[model samples]
Target: MPEQYLKKILTSRVYDVARETALVRAPSLSRRTGHTVWLKREDEQDVFSFKIRGAYNKMAQLDADTLARGVVAASAGNHAQGVAMAAQRLKCQATIFMPVTTPAIKVSAVRNRAARVRLVGDSFDETLAAAQVFCEKNAQ
Candidate 1:
């Protein structure tokens, strides 16, 4: 890897919401594969999703006005949860657009994090379209 990219990654502010988690050795997998194996415990994160790092990093870069205007995104699962968790931590409103086909548990999780869940469309593509409309209307 290039030194500059490595430096940027090491200096990233994603640490505010995501801590440095140690890799746990996958002993059985390592033995079977004849190679040392390790697994990152991103599940240990507050959102139980690795996507929180990227979500928080991007949102953290926004100006206060933008954040105050709120965030809107389209996702049925992990990304939705991450955005919801990040928004809650930042004290901003978040609207997650998900397909009506999404499971109740997933919807409940996002809502639990204080983000609004909008169940639109029967498929993910339609759900994304609905979120895009929100972005265009809100100038996001």
Candidate 2:
């Protein structure tokens, strides 16, 4: 399993949607701690989060049939935006199920990424259940 993970990491297709973030020194933190500190700028990604990489990589590796059937995900935060953007990049139809309580800004962000957004239940679990049902009904 470790070898498989290593291979996946080595060959990940995240670059299609994510850039190689830099490690930059944190001057203030370093000074406070009396030691060197570096921060990984994952926020440099197009989605402004590291989630895009994994989302894109997973979509990139999907079988043609699966891609054709499209994808469904349940998220109300960065992951929703990540999946939406990844699906757009892959030219695959995507459905994002977000909790009804999600902020309007976040919902708009996910919608702007070109995925079909569904405002479902108020909790993550309920939202996830809605997504699962959608997947089953749509044969995703």
Candidate 3:
């Protein structure tokens, strides 16, 4: 997509929200490895990760009718939180799936975003399968 046209389609407020994220220089890692290293400081985000940026960006593009129908997504960590936050901000229902072994931190992160969290299967693949089934059944 053309960058300028794409920018116009997205709401300015959402972009503002994402812009608060920091881009931290990786001084220690760079020095240790003798390589250029930098970290996109998504950890400073409102939800404490980069997920919000992509999630909000995607949800912000959905039409009203589709938003009313809600959205479903499967993710293990950061992406899940991002999707959940985006859905909540858009006032669209969100269903998220995480593997059974996902750390509590990740699960809590999504829950804190007000996104419904479901623990299923053992690996990302299995969790994704369950999420797909749920989405199909829910008609999301």
lDDT string, candidate 2, 1-140, tens digits: 69998997878898667888999999999999999999999988878899998898889999988988889999978998899999898888888999999999999988888888999997999999999998888777
Residues 1-140 of candidate 1: C-alpha lDDT, one tens digit per residue: 99999998988878888977769999999999999999999988888879999998888888999999999999988999999988998999999999999999989999999999999999999999999998999887
Tell me how far candidate 3 lies from the true structure as C-alpha RMSD in angstroms: 3.1
Error of 3 at 54 (Å): 1.2
Tens digit of per-residue lDDT, candidate 3, span 1-140: 99997876565446745756566789899999999888887677777776677788778888999999888888888889888878877888888899989999989988987888899999999998998898788777
| TM-scores for every predicted model | 0.92, 0.89, 0.80
Q: Could you tell which candidate, 2 or 3, scores higher by TM-score?
A: 2
Off by over 4 Å in 1: none
Error of 1 at 111 (Å): 0.6
Number of clashing residue pairs in every model? 0, 0, 1
User: What's the candidate order when arranged by decreasing lDDT?
Assistant: 1, 2, 3
Q: Each candidate's root-mean-square deviation in Å? A: 1.3, 2.3, 3.1
TM-score for candidate 3, please give it.
0.80
Q: Which stretches of model 3 miss by more than 4 angstroms?
A: 1-16, 33-36
Q: Which residue pairs show collisions in model 2?
A: none
